[model samples]
Target: MYALVDCNHFFVSCERLFRPDLRNHPVCVLSNNDGCVVSLSHEAKILGIKRGVPLFQIADIVKKNNIAIFSSNYLLYSGISERVMKIITDTAKNVDVYSIDEAFIDLRNYEKKELVPLMRLLAEKIKKWVGIPVSIGVAPTKTLAKVAAHYAKKYKGYKQVCCIDDEQKRVKALSTFDIADVWGIGRQFSKKLTSFGVNTAYDFTQKKEFWVQKHFTIMGVRAWKELQGIPTINTTEINRKQSICTSRSFGATVTDIESLKESIAHFTAMSAQKLRKQNSIANIISVFILTDRFSKQEEHYYHTRSMALPVGTNDTAELILYAHQLLTELYKRGKAYKKSGVILSGIVPNSSVQQNMFDNLKNREKRSLLNKVVDNINSKSGLNSVKYAAQISTDKKWTTKTSFKSPDYLTNINELFEVH
Candidate 1:
C-alpha cells in the first residue's frame, strides 16, 4: 500500500508554524513581489478569497476582514519542507518526497487498524515537532492514496488520516469523489469523461481499460487502474524534468528598456543556476515578454523568440548574453511590458551532450569553473553577491512586491524574532 501525506495550506501553514497564533485565522501567501494570492488557508477560502486574485483587488477585502497576508518566503518554506521530509523518512521504510508539502510512503506492511493509530501518532508528532499539519491517505496505489489524503483533509472525522485498505471503503470513496478531482484527470479530460457519463472516480474506474487507453493515453489507463485500487504508478523517483522555465511578474509594471533588460538578465541567471543544479544543458533558449493582458488599452502584445545555441551550455554568462541579444531584438521602444520569462528547452544531462568541433564556442572549462565559483560565493552569501553587468544598478522596481512578507525565521538571523 502507498500512503500520500500532504501538508495543509502549505505556504500559509509554514508561516503559521512559527506564529501559532495565526492558527484558524484567515491567512494567505502571496506570489513573489506580492503579485496575487498564491496560497490561501481554509478560513481565507471560506471568506471568498480565490487563488490567483490580484493583491490590489483583494486589498480592501483583506483589510476589512482582517486577513493576514504574507510574501512568499521560500527560505523558510524550504527549511520546513526539509524538516517535514526528514520526519517522514525517519518514520517510513520507503518514502518519496513528491513535492514541498507532499510525500508518498509505502505502507504495505501495516494492517488498517494498526496504520490508522500509527498515522494519527505520526500526524501529531509532525504537528508538535515540525509545526506542520499533514493529512495522510493510505491505499494500494499512489493515486488512491492521493484521493484518500484529499478526503482526509476535507473530512474532520478521519482524524487527519484516512485509510482505504478495504475494497468496500475504497469503492465508496471513489464513488463520492468527482472525476475532475482525481489526481491525473485535467479539465479537458474531465469534460470528455463527463460527456461519457464518467463524472465520478467510480464511473471512471468502471470504464474498460481499452476505452481509457484509446481516449486518454497511457497515463489515463494507469490512473483508471489506480482508481480501481490497482497499483500502476511506481514510487520510484523519475529523474527527468520535461521543461524548466523561470519567470516572474514585476513588483510594478515596467516600461523602460533598461529595467526590462535587467529583469531578463536576472531571470536568465536564475534559469542557468537551475540548469546547472540539475546537471543539464539546454540546446534552445526561449525569451518572452508581454504587457498586462488585462490592460484597457487594446494593445495586448506578447513576443516569444527561440534561439538555438551553437552548443548546449549551463553557463550563466553565455545564457544571459544570448538572452540580452533576444531582449534587444524583441523590446520595442513604445511597448509597455508587465512580465517577462526565459525558457530553456531541449535539455539533456551535461554528460550526454556532444560537443561541436567546428563552432567557435566559449572556453567550456573556464566557464564551468567561473560558474562554480560564483555559485559557491553566492550560496555562502546571498543572491547578487556576483551579478552580470546588465543586472547592475537596475532599479529594484523590477522586483516582486513583497511588502507583507513574513520573516525567514529559520535562515535569516536578522529576521528572527524573540519574545519574552
Candidate 2:
C-alpha cells in the first residue's frame, strides 16, 4: 500500500505554528518580494482571497477583512518541513519525499496494523509534535494515494486520513475528481483531455491505448495504469536532480564588475554547498548577468557564459574562481546588471567521479577539507559566519527587503522562539 502525506496550507501553517492566535483566522503567505499570494488558510479562502492574487489587488479586501499577511520565509518553511518529516519518518517504515510539503510512506510492513487508525495516529503525532496539520491518503498505488489525499483534504468526514482499499471506493473517488487534478496530468494534458470528453479521473482510464499514447505517450499511460490501481510508477526509488542552480534577483541593481563578481562568487559558493550536500560534483559552471528589462532608460542586456572545469569539483573556492573568470569574460564596462546567478551542471555523484589520469590538479584533498570546515562553521554559527576574502571585500552590495519575514526560529539559536 502507498500513503501520501501532505501538509495543509504549508506556508501559512508554518507561520501559524508560532502564532497560535492566527489559527482559524484569514491568513495568506506571499511569494518572492511579497508579490502575490502563494498559500492561504481555509479561513482566508472563505473570505474569497484566491491564491496567486497580487497583494496590490487585494489590499482593500485585506484591510476590510482584517487579513493577516506574511512574506515567504523559505528558511522557516524548510525548518518546519524537516521537523514534520521527522515525525512522519518515525511512524512509517519506508518513505519517499515527493516535495517539500508532501511525502509518500510505504505501508507494506504495517499490514498487521489497523491502516486507517494507524494513519490517524501518525497524523495526530505529527500535529502534536510539529504544530502543523497533515492529511494522509492511502490506496493501492501512488497515483490513487495522491487522489485519496485530495479527497481527504476537501471533506472533513475523513478525519484527516482517507483510505481507498476497495475498487468501489476508488471508482467513486475517481468519478468526482477532475482529470486535470490528477497527479501527473498538467495544464496542457488537461485541456486536451477535456476536449476529448475526459472530464473525470475515471474517464481518463477508459481511453484506448492508441489515444493515450498519441496524447501523452508512455507517461500518460503510466498515470492511466496507476489510476486503475496498478503501480506503473516506481514510488520506492529516488532520482537525483540533473542540475542544481542558485540565483536570485538583487535587492538593488549592480553597475560594476567587482560587485557583480561578488554576487556571482556568493552564488557560486551557495551552489557548491548544494552540490556537496547532495554528494555530487559538477563539470560545468554557467553564469548569467542581466539588466532590468523594465528599465526604460537603460538598454536591456543579458550576458551568459558556461565553461567546463578542468576537473569536476564541489569545492567552493574552485567554483568561486571559475565564477569570477566567467564574470570577467562576460562583464561589460557599464551595463547596470540587475540580476546574476550561477548554475552547476553535468553533475555526478562524488563517489562516481572518475579522476582524469592525464590532468594534474593539486591540493584537491586540502580544498575539500577547507570547504567542509567553512560549511560546518556556517551550519553551526549561522550562514555567512565565514566567507571567502573576495566575498568579504566586495564594495558592490545588494540586499533583500524582507520586512515581514519571521525569525529563523528553528535553525538559528538567537532567533529561537521564546515564551514571554
Candidate 1's displacement at residue 293, Å, is 3.8
**Candidate 1 lDDT score relative to the true structure:** 0.85
Assess candidate 1 and give its TM-score to the true structure: 0.87
All candidates' TM-scores? 0.87, 0.91
Alpha-carbon local distance difference test for all models: 0.85, 0.86
Which 10 residues in a row give candidate 2 its minimum summed lDDT? 394-403
Q: Can you write out model 1's per-residue Cα lDDT over 1-420, one digit (the tens) per residue?
A: 888889999999898887889898999998887778999999999899999998899888898999998999876787788899898899878888777798888877777668888888889989989879899998888999999999999999999999888889988998899999898788888999999988899988888888887899777888898888788876442434546799988878888888888888889998898788678899999999998889897488899998999898888888998998998889877766889999998888888777888757658888798999998876655556688887786266677777887776765668776787
Prediction RMSDs, each to the true structure: 3.1, 2.5
Clash-forming residue pairs, model 2: none
User: What is residue 35's positional error in candidate 2, in angstroms?
Assistant: 1.7
Q: Using TM-score as the measure, which candidate wins?
A: 2
